[model samples]
Target chain A: MAREASVSEVLLDARGIAKSFGGVQALRDVSLTIGRGEIYGLIGPNGAGKTTFFNVLTGLYSADSGEVQFDGARLDIGLPHLVTRQGIARTFQNIRLFANMSALENVMVGRHLRSHASVIGAVLRNRATRREEADIVDRAHRLLRYVGVDARANDLARHLSYGDQRRLEIARALATEPKLLALDEPAAGMNATETASLRQLVESIRADGVTVLLIEHDVKLVMGLCDRVAVLDYGEKIAEDVPDRVQRDPKVVEAYLGGALA
Target chain B: MTTLEGKRRDPRVALAGTLLLAVALALAPFAVGAGAGIAWVRVIDFALLYIMLALGLNIVVGFAGLLDLGYIAFYAVGAYLYALLSSPHLAGAFPSLAPGLHWPIWAILPLGALVAGAFGVILGAPTLRLRGDYLAIVTLGFGEIIRIFMNNLNRPVNLTNGPQGITQIDPIGIGGVSFGRTLDVFGIGLPSVYLYYYLFLGATLLVVFVSIRLEDSRIGRAWVAIREDEIAAKACGINTRNIKLLAFAMGASFGGVAGGLFAGFQQFVSPESFTLMESVMVLCMVVLGGMGHIPGVIFGGILLTLLPEALRYGAGPVQTALFGKVLVPPESLRMLLFGLALILVMLYRPAGLWPSAIRRREFAGAGNSPENGAGSERE
Candidate 1:
């Protein structure tokens, strides 16, 4: 609805996306457009292809057939790192921080795609490399601050409380300076207080001029945070409209509600 | 200034300890000679050499988490480079492997490193693509191939002495000073032990420094990143395959430098010394020392080397006293005990006795590092 009602630029337009596992089609002809600086929510039942869509968009897995366009650039998403470098980043459904590394280091890794210092520079510990490294460290700290994780910078990422890790993951992704970010189940295990914080955080990311593609199961959270919503059931998009319309769509309710949500 | 920021106060303590050790080593010649004391000095040299090799292996297996079973190949290459350069045996054949080679030992040492590093790239290019178990098997095969090449391959042209190995390698001489025979230095007699012992000590320190530095760099971070979670590392823009190959090439060169020093010190190079067991022994050092840890690997290497030598002498007497005959000799019981100990360590402390702080957490419990801990939270 954000793009359909506006004349602004499209940051990411994913069309006719399809994926399969052996004989099962995990996703089928799913399509969604995320306008620049907007929060787009993708919703579905369990195994409704929400993560499959995120995986395809983030380059974790290639779609069997589809087109992913980010800033008008075609994306086969052959390599996750390449997609990340093209200014698209995402969190895993399960958190994936570098365990032994300090939280600061975890965020610094996000700055890795940005640091182009060569092997020779690193091996010799040259001045340019040192400068680059210091810059990255500073940016990493700044990013940690943005996510409210600055106090935990010295802590090993694994040692952080669950809520903090999710926040840190968002911070790490932001350090990549992405134009579009996909967050997979960021609130899956959070308490109400933490989810409230995440909602604010996502809003803040959008306020910073980056588009968001969200894979979330919490319909209430989606309805509150997203400007537009896309619904998938059994690998196909059944509804694409404002969250209110998505909630009222009979096909979506039949596919997901089974009965009224408690 | 590096990633080891937690090391400031610790390095000062280490420097003091190293100074104390250097002083004791300087005075050791007075304790005895030719007897077990001289043998003890030789034992320290071997330990230091093993420490260097183990440190390199640690970078590959511990830091990069790429299990290598044929690390001895680099050792062989370094020894051969030293032999071909410092001796006339293969000098008549491939002179580049030997070179004008009249450069100082310090100069040749780096060349040996380069040669070994080059080979590391060669092996790692194809093999680093393999996983843990497959890498181990391939490395084991590579080690055997080097040993076999060293053992055979004699031609109409004389080179390597064909199982006879290279003998009478010239020891390093600085200016006009001879390091081969004993001499006087600072009122203390400079024996062969003193010459090579200091050399080995210096090399060991260099290895430790470089390994620690490598572990913290973008390269080191890339390695640990891969080790902890490879898919994530690559997703983070690390070329995992190339990063793994870098780990291999970098790790292998340490073995080369140690091999070169060994060749110079021994004044002989034998194919037999570069055996499958030697590789296994170094692997054990990394395992025993605590993976990806500099101090642990050094201590582990020294302890492992000296324990057998100590047992050799102690075993003869203890067995004689108990059984009226030698019960288990050092060579036999040492290995049996070594094997059993690794088994026990793996079963009880799978991470190691003193693993890298990160690896300790990686193995200790469920996912402390959110990414790596994913599957571990299983029933």
Candidate 2:
């Protein structure tokens, strides 16, 4: 059954985004736009630099040329917190949940964006400080519940099962209240059962009004779930369209099958 | 102790604990043994002071996951500020803030905190940009910088009395009564040492209470988030730079307050007191207790301090009876044993002797399962 997606507005718009490591070109002349409440999947063959594109977008690596504009604001370099405050959040391909922290702590970190105590207030322990701190703890738990981990709220993040950890990572990301949530391989290590759950979770997130950028290797999952598909090959966009169109594009086929996909 | 039960417990437990701690602190100086009642009182006073230092360092190294090797620099600045302004040596040099309004400790302490906080800000400003080993090296360098400046500035005529040190410093005055002077009570004069010891204990408890409360707060959560994963913390809009500086300044000021007390208590202080070794000692307390754990740090500070003194006085009679020697000979083997202990402990208990519950759960959870395994039934 096909569920109707809400109006899709241009949520993220990038133009001529270029990045290099020394003389090695990682991303060059890349341009793409993601719509509000849209699920976009990015796929490419090994060494095609999809991860590099993720890095540049999240401010882990700076782009050498062009601009990244999200919600009408140009992205700046080296200020990840600002990117976050601007309503953009992401998870790592390798799962970078705070391993030593509880699932609750990881989410509280995301909610830290809303706190407003100057350094002085923290030390003074005034009335406002107390109120702000209590609110953070309360909201952090709410976020935990929203992501379906309220029961295991106090459990260490690393201790969670593989699938649950991925869910918690999403919760932690959502704690930031981002307009767009970027998941770098949310289904990377999951089995089929986990992937099915992830598909449902993605739909649920989009239902909540957040646009999602999913980087997935599972072709079936990507084709079935994504509203739009963008394929990259050798640091250049080879195709961007509906899943069926992306699948038939000869350039995408050559990039994936090294000749022509079935 | 109720806080140990987690934040969901009764609020009265916390409030009662605070009141009980306040009462106990106020009574400690009057019931001591061994050293002069005065000296023992000062020892407890310093113990409370060290507790504050440990609690603050816990935030930077304990909560935030940042390794700071030079936390004593802020302490040195607070000590020197009080020493330079309130002492007789300054009277001869330039008597403006010097002889410092004879301001009460209640007044001097906050000013001391601000002065130390500002120093923390200054040090954190340029150095907070560095992370991991680089940050450690930079902090280490800053510690040395403050130490060297203190030492060098003391020479050539002497605003700081050169290495001669400063003296005739006044103790805190409350209302109209000076704490440094003894008081009349029930036909007997209670000593000033008792007064200061209790006051210091109160301050230590205050810092500890605030620190534990703050750890679970938004800022507290942010510090741990940054510690666990920097890129993620910022992605959450944590303002990593500001949080890091908050940790730095908060940690430093506690040590600074300790320094101020040292100046006032000893009534004499010099550049020699705030050395790089001082920084190492404070770090040892935090590490030995458990980084990022408050009670562990306080315990660490007290135990580490009392151990050496115990060895000195404790072994004296035994050594004299056995080898016809005093307890500790010149140059104790403590340094060797200290390093050996750290290595042994790290091998066995990297989570710390008494780590904060969250830290223990985080690190220990790696191998063991919770009583109910990590994954719920999802029912």
Candidate 3:
């Protein structure tokens, strides 16, 4: 279903990325090329370095030796906010909404980079600042509605239902207007129905022209939803292909079963 | 929680409330007889000054969620700047160093604020990576270091006049109207204390207005987001380092303005005035009143400032009536009761005496499951 994206221009190219913590090598020479508008999936067993790679791409962790290019520009992978400014936004493995802020506020914070109101403007609240502020609110409300969580726009993020919180997180990420939106285990705690809705939402996001990079342990959903699947085993990419082929690859099967059996 | 179109109240109601508050403030200093009215007004003036300081600290501690223990350093900077610029002590010591700057109050206020804001940035830069307790410790040390500098800088140079502090500092005035003298207005004589009271009140209101504006601005939202989760805030494209520095600079500027006002009002400033206790008291005001709520913080500032003085007067009389004599020194008893009141307020109103609406909701829903009470079931 997502194969058309594979034929499009490449959007994010992370090359030979490696990261380690003390004695543990979290990632080793992992590389990926996600086409524009692709819903790419990364799956692995426990400690397989899926999240490590995600963090590196999103600027939470600086790679020991690597290079990432977004929209054909060399991405400096040191500061997370800079990574976001370069048009990549991400959600955490555990949902990390500004827990105490209202859902609307969480989305507005995502608009931080997009809006340009300085201290002087805010203090004086002149016409331009007021208009920008109003526009921010309008767009935030629209994003909340886009994610189907507008009704809970005023509720604190922590007080939202688990699935709605996930959706709200998506709304926040979307508010950044990123070319690439990365989700880390977005469906980790969702039920079947919740997962279905989340899948539809991810599709609609891709349909809206934003590329998505998904990291999940839920192989079934990934295999069904993603255009191409990459499987990691013990911090190494074991397979990369269409989902059917990646699923059939013996090394991929062995890595998953081996970890489960062990 | 403060959306641009969140809620609207009637303008008439708001105007009425403002008028009532203004009238109350205007008439408050005269409540006591003329004999004791000056002292009472002085206490209120100090309370207003403290309110400005608390509002400044709230920008850092409440809005940005930075635990600043050395915030008094900025206040000291402002005070000392005003002292050096406006007092003749510098001329007495140096004689040839331009015969004492004696800069005007208007000029000194902005200079004080700018210098204090610079100090704030200096402190904020090194502590960007620190969180909570560690940040508090560093700030506390910073506060003490500034005090120790002021206390000892008198040696070989006599910049601050050592432990004695600066004296004969010019009182704040504008356009030939000296605030240091009583003025007759509309057939009523307003004392110097009353004049200063009005000045402090105006400054306090300005600070409150600026605080409210910043509270709902883009920068304010960034601060709250950083406070909530630094990592998430970064992912949302907020430059946490710069924003944190901004919080410090903005907060410290307020302290600086308050410090200038304080120095001008008292006509003296010493290292003793900028102690660690003052910083803690300001923090307490932010917490006890309502961490991020403007009115709560103002109330907290006023309450904490006036409470000790009130206790000083009432403690001795109460002890004499109850124990047939004053058992503990009134000073000690005042602090003891003050401590007891803080503990009780913390125990009962854990959120604060008056918290922001969101904080109130959080406290109200404390024991409920995250997804239970205010949330819809999973779809």
Error of 3 at A203 (Å): 0.4
Q: Is the docking of candidate 2 incorrect, acceptable, medium or high quality?
A: medium
TM-score of each: 0.88, 0.90, 0.95
Candidate 2 lDDT over B1-379, as tens digits, reads 1223356747898899988976765555655633344566666667777788778778888777777888888887878777775666655655554544355566677788888888888878897656668888998998888877777775564666656667778776678777787888788787887777766776787888778767756777778777777766666777778888888878777777878887787778777887778777788888878887778898988877765655555455767899888746623745555667778877787766887776566556546532122122111
- DockQ by candidate, in order: 0.47, 0.50, 0.61
State the lDDT of candidate 3 residue by residue for B128-175, as single tens digits: 988778899999999999999999998887899989999899888888
Residue B139 lDDT, candidate 2, scale 0-100: 88
Clashing pairs for model 2 are B62-B292, B154-B162
Between candidates 2 and 3, the lDDT winner: 3
Model 2 C-alpha lDDT per residue in residues A148-243, reported as the tens digit of each score? 778888777877888889989998888788899998989988999989988988899999899999888889999999988888888898888888
TM-score of chain B of 3: 0.94
lDDT per residue as tens, model 1, A1-262: 3335442778888889999999999999887778888899888889898887887887778888989888889975767788888888888788887777788888887777788765556666788888988899899889888889899897778889999999988888888888888899999999999999999999999998888888898889999999888888889998888888778888888887586666
- The clash tally of candidate 3 reads 0
> Taking the tens digit of each residue's C-alpha lDDT, what string does model 3 give over A76-101?
79899999999999998878888878
lDDT value, residue B48 of candidate 1: 88
